[model samples]
Target: MPIFLEAKLLVWLSPLHRESWLWACPELEEKPYAIVPSPIDPSQFYDMKLPREGVICVTSLFEFKGRKNVLQWARDHPGQEITCAGGNPLPNEPLPPNCRDVGQISPWQVNETYNKHKAFLHLPATPQPFDRTVSEAYLAGCDIIGNKLIGALSYDWFKSREEVAEHCGNSSKLFWEKIEEVLND
Candidate 1:
């Protein structure tokens, strides 16, 4: 906190984080700060026009990431295809029969995964500072189903996962407009 105060500038990746930081230290209100989200190369992630089938959850296989919730959801929806990407499942944490665990996918592969999957789930136990996966999924045209704390400015407040998924899909122009707005600010 002391070092932060001494710093000339603070670059926040998302407004949610910026707001949390300001709330934590009201004294920092006068400090210089900017919310610039991590960049995503459009060339690397294009709409492949692939069939958006099945559900996918991308995140480290940690308990707090709501891996258990994903597993339970998979169990409840046996007919739906579910894929879990990121690190391997924890010891003794066997995945359900309906779920396929693709541990630790590369960024390029993640783009492809997002393109292929129709829905993306991110049910983290705690609030995320910023979930880049959500943006990636949205960019790739996947339906987003996650908690409100995802920190992506594009998503509207949604109650149910289905409600969120219904609003999936993104416009590159809109995304670029947001980037320009933040950068120009």
Candidate 2:
């Protein structure tokens, strides 16, 4: 009588942000995880780089604007660290590590990356239907920082970009306070 994208429930089953980001990077299918844009590959728009400033992968244009603000704040404060990667899910951005294919990365590998990274930076550069990045980072256990409010199925798990900036401007306590509020519930 009827059909579906795959016939299965196609569940959104995730702790928070994992599933959405996995799909964004086709190259990551084997490993399947989110990553910053790949500079070497122009077509597969993964992470965004600001010259000597640094790099960040945008979940979408909406996220781009939010990250820009963080960039400005980080510039003023200076000294923040970020790591990048990519794979097949992206037709736009290329993978940074030539051998350790992102699409094929195991959960443990993904966890390793997560442990080293401080937070997930998602700034919606534009206003669109919804950006799934917030959920991706949350699911992966990355401290999410962004402007776009993804009040979707998990309506309670996001914060405005402005909030993130405030936390950045203030002490680390504020940062965890916000994170606890959003994810703990």
- Steric collisions counted per model: 1, 41
Residue 183 of model 2, lDDT score: 55
Q: Write the per-residue lDDT of candidate 1 for residues 11-121, one digit (tens) a residue.
A: 676667777778888888887765555555545555689888898888735777777667777888899888888876584678788878887787658778888898888
Residue 10's lDDT within candidate 2 is: 21
Q: Which candidate is the best by lDDT?
A: 1
How do the residues 1-185 of candidate 2 rate in per-residue lDDT, one tens digit apiece? 12322222222222234334344533333431221110111112122221222223333322234445544544453455433333334445432331122334453354345434446555444432334444333333455655543322233323543332232233245434544554565
In model 1, the runs with Cα more than 4 Å from the true position are 89-91, 153-185
| Candidate 1 collision pairs | 86-104
- The Cα local distance difference test for each model comes to 0.69, 0.36
The window of 10 residues in a row where model 2 has the poorest summed lDDT is 36-45
